[model samples]
Target: MTDPKISAFYVAVQEVNSLIQNGGTSSSRSLEEKIVEHLENAQLLGKLPKMGGAQEEVFMEVTKHGLRISAARSRLVKLRIPLIELVLLTTFVDGFGKTHAVFVEKSTTTRYQLHLLQLADDMAANVLCSLVKNAFVEAEEASALIEVIEPPSPSIA
Candidate 1:
């Protein structure tokens, strides 16, 4: 199944690329405006769904990593992605666009590289795999006959 978040991320990336191509001079204002417009239109800043238990912790960790943008400048620029949603968003639904995951090594005083990954298959399988791994193992084969039990009439009391 095609994930909607992935499509939205692609659209956002295309918008930014088009803006950059047409922005003439490489001005920070122009690029920033373009990002604001696209993010607002996509409505990704809205509320994210609740994920309980261990999944929530994983979601938090992924979010912390997802929006780790590094920029050297004089102006204040802030980008935010809800932590939990990003895991799912970037998984099957969201694309990296111009931005991507990276590892920074302070020793070099530079970004190592931008790494990209697709989430579709991994996200879907993780859920099922976790369930299977956690399920109890039974020692004997258990079979039960199908039976319909109707409630007795209330007046019987």
Candidate 2:
């Protein structure tokens, strides 16, 4: 049986990719706004896990080595992991605007890999590939946009 968490992650990725692919031309909302709305809706619908509280933050960074996914629970502490530890099994983009990526943990030999879905236009796909490649170049670290935000305020009000 497929893991529910993985399924939800795939769904969220697919929706985000679709929005990026279409460039929000057909929707009244801008792409940035639509992304935030979609994320909230996904969490509400149980397609993505909800944050435990206002202090929790999750982010992904493409570094000179590999993708780093980090979860910060408190203001000063975070856990970061490398995405390359997962083996990419397969990837495909269909004519129907669907893209699928499968990955398995490096320690696992199972045929099944975590599945990720996305939508992308030709331009977006090219750009994504280029960016990923650049992320692996050691020199790119100087130019990469990292650590975008400061710690959130303890309270909004």
Candidate 3:
């Protein structure tokens, strides 16, 4: 996040269908390709094509609480999502020749969103995805570092 060269981006956001996933053992590169294929299939099926309403210039950052999306100038929060609730994040180029970062949220409805972010450029998208995925992995590792044990209850006389 502290990279001096991080670029500012104008981003479009929209609620979308969840992405299709494969068996858990695939490599990272293959998983990304799978996301692209799934999205293309979705578009061909008349789903979530060119659907983002508007593009807002935003200063997005990865925070301890999760990813925080803010209005670029005013700094007001647009969306704040806890990473634990974020099921998946991937990037793909769309039929309209635009790139997007799509993710699924598991909070309640298992909803997903497509962000037509400028970060969708190949290098930027890859970097952002890696940052998020690595952070999520780190969070899971931290939580699993401890073991929980149940205490026995005393018998009443």
| lDDT of every predicted structure (CA atoms) | 0.28, 0.39, 0.60
lDDT of 1 by residue, 48-132 (tens): 1211212111111112123222222322222333322221222222332332111111122231211122223454435422322
Instruction: Tell me, by TM-score, which candidate is best.
Output: 3
Per-residue lDDT of candidate 3, residues 83-129 (tens digit): 87775677766777666676555555645655545553677777777
TM-score of each candidate structure, all chains considered together: 0.20, 0.33, 0.60
Give the lDDT of residue 31 in candidate 2. 46
- Tens-digit lDDT track of model 2 for 1-157: 1111111012322323344456547678764455445544665677753333232333334454454334433333132224455333334443334443323333333222232333233443344345455644544454354555466779867
Instruction: Tell how far residue 103 is off in model 3, in angstroms.
Output: 1.7
Q: Tell me the alpha-carbon RMSD of every candidate.
A: 19.1, 18.9, 6.0
Off by over 4 Å in 2: 1-9, 12-61, 68-83, 89-91, 101-104, 107-112, 139-157
Question: Model 1, 23: alpha-carbon shift in Å?
Answer: 1.4
Give the C-alpha lDDT of model 2.
0.39
Better of 1 and 2 by TM-score: 2
Error of 3 at 102 (Å): 0.8
Which run of 10 residues does model 1 get worst, by summed lDDT?
51-60
Model 3, C-alpha of 88: deviation from truth (Å): 1.6
